[model samples]
Target: MSKINLKKILTYGLVVFFIVGAVGNLIGPEKILEDYARWGYPNGFHLVTGSFELLAAILIFKSSTRFIGSLLASCIMFSAILTLSYHAEYSHAFIPLIVFMLLLVSIYLHKQKKLL
Candidate 1:
């Protein structure tokens, strides 16, 4: 596929990904709560994460702010990767790592498009 198409696909896909992440964190399901606790995060930290994820999703959905959104998402994904890796939760780390890489590509595409 063309770069334009690829970028569109990645951008929309990331928007969806962040939206889901935001909801999952905001909902604070038992498994997620336990994971956050296991990672030594303060109680209610998920709220902050969810808020940022939601912001990223919003920014990403807008063409004018896609790069900025990707940057914000990259930060979150990086933190997740670090936390998971530090805890030796490699399996859990995998998804964040993949998302982080996709965010990087999305950012690059935005830069190439001079949308940054």
Candidate 2:
């Protein structure tokens, strides 16, 4: 496939992933709430995170805002990694770390003008 196609695939994949995650956060499942409580966050904080996630995912679809979206997503993932690690949830932390790397790649490609 062409480089443009690959970039589109990656961008869309990230968008889907973030959207799913945001929806889950907004839905606030039992386990998710438990995790937040364990992490010392208020119950309502999930909604806040979910809102940001949704906004970032939407921004990522537009060329002009893609960098900011990636940056926000990266920040969110980094925060998740740190919080999970603080709770000794190593396995859980790994997932966010992976997402963080993907966000970094998104940021790089966006800056390199390869993602438009």
Candidate 3:
């Protein structure tokens, strides 16, 4: 596959992931709140994060705003990973950290057209 095709695929996949996460948070507020509470965040934070994720998803779907959206989404994931690392056991934090790092790499590849 070509570099451009790989970038497009990754971008589409990331957008779908973000959109699904946003929709999940919106549809399952209680589950998200439960997870957040376990990580020590307040109930209101779930709504705020959900909104941010939704907006990021929308922005990511647009080519013009993709880089900024990817950066913001990375920030959000990084924040969540840190929060979980701070409050939860190490094992619980590992997955998020790995996921966030993968996201960072994905964004980097997209930016450099190296995904091919």
Candidate 3 segments exceeding 4 Å error: 1-4, 109-116
lDDT of 2 by residue, 5-52 (tens): 877887888898889989999999999898789899986899999998
Instruction: Please provide, for model 3 over 1-116, each residue's C-alpha lDDT reduced to its tens digit, 9 standing for 90 to 100.
Output: 64567667767777777787778777766667788788777767777787888887888788778778888888878887778767756676776576577668666765775346
Stretches of candidate 2 off by over 4 Å are 1-4, 114-116
Ranking by TM-score: 1, 2, 3
Tens digit per residue, CA lDDT, model 1, 42-67 = 99999999999999999999989888
Clashing pairs in 2: none
Worst lDDT 10-window in candidate 1: 1-10
For each candidate in turn, the TM-score is 0.93, 0.91, 0.77
TM-score of 2: 0.91
**Per-model CA lDDT versus the true structure:** 0.93, 0.88, 0.75
Off by over 4 Å in 1: 1-4
Give the candidate number with the greatest lDDT. 1
What's the lDDT of the predicted structure labeled candidate 1? 0.93
**lDDT of model 3 at residue 100?**
70
- Ordered by lDDT, highest first, the candidates read 1, 2, 3
